[model samples]
Every structure is written in structure tokens, then in C-alpha cells.
Target: MTNPDDPRSLELVETELPQLRDGEVLVKVQAAGVNRGDLLQARGYYPPPPGESEIIGLECAGVIEDPGTTGRRKGEAVGCLMAGGGYAEYVAVPEGQLMPIPEGYSPTETAAIVEVACTVWSNLGMLADVRPGQTVLIHGGAGGIGTFAIQLCRELGATVAVTAGSAEKLETCRELGADILINYREQDFSEELKGKCDVILDIMGAKYLQQNLRALNEDGQLIIIGLQGGVKAEINLGALLPRRLTVRGTTLRARSLEGKAEIVRSAVENVWPMLADGRISHHIHATFPLAEAAAAHELLDSGAVTGKIVLEV
Candidate 1:
């Protein structure tokens, strides 16, 4: 039998505390966001990039535990979209990726907001150039990223359309400013939304690709941020040419520290204020103690969470 003192499984092991480098800040994690990438990593199908620690979480909010060659005062609360290791009691992030927790936001609330906001802003705000008056179609509209994307797109003056699995989830999306809601289980969304959108924020991949491209208006952008559906498929450039549609995909965990830090900088300058002033709120579905992270992951894996699942430390 494996000794509890030397647990070998992903969730049970307790290793020596990790260290921080120059330009890094050690966070005493209060809560961590459980993302899809964490699930993949725990299964050993994905790993943090080179130079990143082999821990499972991607983002967290916490108090500063140690400062390494940086000027951040210890005990100040901060939030970070990290490369890995956020599931622990402590995680180190480069100072550049750190931001003061949004004013009036507690660590748990900030934990729910940081990753989805960073992800949406990076892909929708930066890459796709989603602008006001453009219509955006978002899939998985009830998930963490979708909820944030719906609000941010609306805040940007775009008309928003979304597809969730149920009427209840659709109502939540609509409450968050979705102009149109499609229940995928009951209707053909792209068929219902024909020629209606100027941008598409897609989470389901190849399965929706063809119809999504058909749904875009001229000069439209389709940015795929998740592949909940299978990834491989053929692309029809012919369909894209006349509409000038842009189909692109991105993953946050694979990005470089510098790239993610740039995302953090932009989010703090832009999206953070919306959160601080109550124009945007983190959709926290539930919280569990740090030791219950496996259950949290199972919850996320179950597809029942309407928003983020957080592990409180």
C-alpha cells in the first residue's frame, strides 16, 4: 500500500513547497480556478510548458507570501493567471502576471474572474478585434469563459448570440445580455442564426465549424477557444473567401509568460474596472476546500457548473 506520507497520486501527493525566482511573487493561494487544462494535466495528457512547475491549476487569487526581487509588499492580496501549480496552498507567479485584486473583490471572487477575463480579452479583445456593433455568436454560453464573453461583448456594444444546452442556461446567458439564445439540444443554432453574426466565439470545434462559417457576415471573425467537440476536420476555404471570415483558435495555458503577462496588463487596465464598479461580476458556481480539488474537477468534468468552480485553500 502507498503510504499517506508518500502519496503517489496527483491529488494526494504533498511535495516540498515550490520556490520563486527573480521577478516572481509567491502567493499564499486563497482560492484557485479549476480549468479544463487542469483536468487534462491531471490525466497526464497535458503538462505545463518548460520552466513551469508540474502542478495543476492555471489561475488563482491569494495573498502575497513571498516577494522575489520585486517590490510587492507581503500580505497584499493579488490575482494571477498562472502557468501551473495554482491548486496548491502556494504558487509563484512572475511579478508581471500579478495584479492587485480588483478593489472590493475578495480572493474567491477574483479567482473566478481572472482566468476567464484574461482568456476572453486575449482572444476576443486582442486577437479577433471584436468591436462595437459587431454581432458575436458564442458557443457554450453557460460556461465560465462564455459568461464573461457574453458580458464583455455586450459591454463593447456588440450584439450577442449564444448556444447553451438547456433553457435554464440560456436564460442565464440572456440575463447576461445575450441578444439571442439557442438551445443546442432542441434547435439547429447556425441554421436559426443564418447570416446574423459578424463574429463567433466558439468553444465547440469541428462539429460546429462548417455551420459557424456559414453563419458569419462579411468580414466576420470566428475565434475558437475550446475544442469540447473533436478537433480534427477539413476546412472549406471556399466558404470563407466570399464572406472574408476569419477562423482562428487559441489556448491560454500554452502561451508564454510574456504573452500572458501582456494579457494581464491589458485586462487590469481595461476589464478590471468593469469588475470593480459592478458592471461585471464573477459567476462563481461553487467553492470547495483545497483538499476537495478532485471533487471540484469532477464537478467541472460533469458539465453541470454554470460558472467557475473554485478550490478554497
Candidate 2:
């Protein structure tokens, strides 16, 4: 999607296959995962990181086009974390970012898994170290990241709390084993869980900043991955100091190749087992053909999608 204001600007243009740099593998993409990062890039608010593709996609599933040294063999079915270009029929990714598809998963299903798994694992498990018995409060619990997080945190032995805008969505969260369900539209979420959270996976930014701090217990960590609410907000050091709180912000697309590779490594090692063993499954809210990318974005904007929207290429 090129134009920020109009989806019609997303024209499908023909292009030559991308050149392979050192440590890169060519992928014949069968599906791609749509993320909020793609939406922001469509709006021109988040452009590609330096030297990355202008095409708007963050993750994909495909077969390896050639033998590569990063542990993937030719013709292997793999899912890749991409900086961009997953929307195309083919994309070139750094070898370290490609991982074998989870056992028995289709290309489309596996496409939706990598982005959320890598994201939640990196922030909650690796960064915050949200261990067993801790309390995790996740906002936007019906989202791709939120759904994956609730299940992962629960499996890790944490009590999961989630805030969704509707009772129906809250029920879905409950089905996912979220212990505490808050209907944000009808309840004061911070008051409901004040001083009770060990970790908060937040998507709402400035709007929830203060309340997120209030929701934290001593030594709590708040990881901000999205800024849907707003960007800038005033934080009281007085409160943060006494609580010994930590606030960290991160994104997957803007990282260096090595950084993303490490995150993918951790995700494959830890999260892939759960998926392959049937302890966890990918949730796909909707699917669309590659040509109907705008409609997929429209579905995403509808605010009713329960999980991910995958584009079949």
C-alpha cells in the first residue's frame, strides 16, 4: 500500500526477483502475514528501515529457492521474518531469519505464527522474564500478539489478565485461558488490577501509560510494542522510583538483521515446540487473496478481527 490516505494506491506492480546478498536466501512466498506494522507503513508513518524493501509485509511462509548456509536446505518449507517484501510471490530474507515450518502446518497458517511468536517471546519471555506464577496483563487481548501472548504466558505458568473492548472478545480471551478478563469499555481496568501485575504487554501507548504504571507491582516491567493511543506522555518518576519499575519499548521490523535473527532463534527453540506438539495453535481471523490486500486492511480496520489476517499469495 503506497498512499497513506487511499488504499487504491496499493498497486500490484511487476518486478524482477531481488538480488541475493551474502547470507541471504530466496524464498518463493506462498503466504504473508499482515501486521499493524504494515498498516503504519501504508500510512507512511513508518517507512522501511534503511536499505530495506518498500513492499509492505513483515512475515511470510514459503519454500527455500536455493541451498543456503544458515541451516535451511533447498525446497524446505519455511517461515521467514521479513523486514518487508513478503507481499510478493518471492522475497529474499537473511538466512538466520528463516525457520522450518511447524510440523503439519500449512504455509498460510505458519505465516501467521512467526510474527506473533517472535514478538511475544522476545518481549515477555526474554526481555521481561515473565516466569511461572507471575501476573501478566495484556491489552488488546483479541489481537494476534495478544492471543499468542495469553496462551504463551499461561503455558509458562503465569496468571494471564486481558482487557478487551467487548464481552464477546473477553469470552474468547477466557477460552484462551486468560484468568482475568476486563471489558475496557465498561470497566476501569487499572482499578481492577491496580498494583497487581508483574508484567504488562501494552499496545495502547500514552493513553494507558499512567494506568499501566499503577497496574504494576514492585519490580514490574511494562513492554510497549504499539502506540495506537498516542506517543508522548508525562511519566511521574516519583511513582516509578518507589516501585522500581522498568519501561521498555521495542519493535521487530526496525532491528538489525542479527537482532531479529536472535529473536527468531529463541522463538523457534522455545515456541515452535508448543505449536508442533499441539499445545498451541495459530489463530487466523481472516484470509484474502494477494490482490485483495486493501480489503484485508479494511477488515483489520474494522476492529473486529480476533487474530491475524493472512494473505494467500
User: Highest TM-score: which candidate?
Assistant: 2
Task: List the pairs of residues colliding in candidate 1.
Answer: none
- Candidate 2 ranges beyond 4 A from true positions: 7-9, 68-72
Q: What lDDT would each prediction earn against the true structure?
A: 0.85, 0.91
Using all chains and alpha carbons, the TM-scores for the candidates as numbered come to 0.95, 0.97
Clashing pairs in 2: none
lDDT of 2 at 176: 90
In candidate 1, what are the lDDT values of residues 1-313, reduced to their tens digit?
A: 0222221234546777888788898899998988877776776767789989887788999898888789889998899888898989889898888987888988999899888999999888888888888888989999999999999999989989999999889999999999988999999987988888888888889888888988888888888887878788798898888878888878888887788889999999989899988888889899999887777877888889898899898
- Taking all chains together, the TM-score of candidate 2 against the true structure is 0.97
lDDT of 1 at 147: 94
Indicate the worst ten consecutive residues by lDDT in candidate 2: 1-10
10 residues in a row with least lDDT, candidate 1: 1-10
TM-score between candidate 1 and the true structure: 0.95
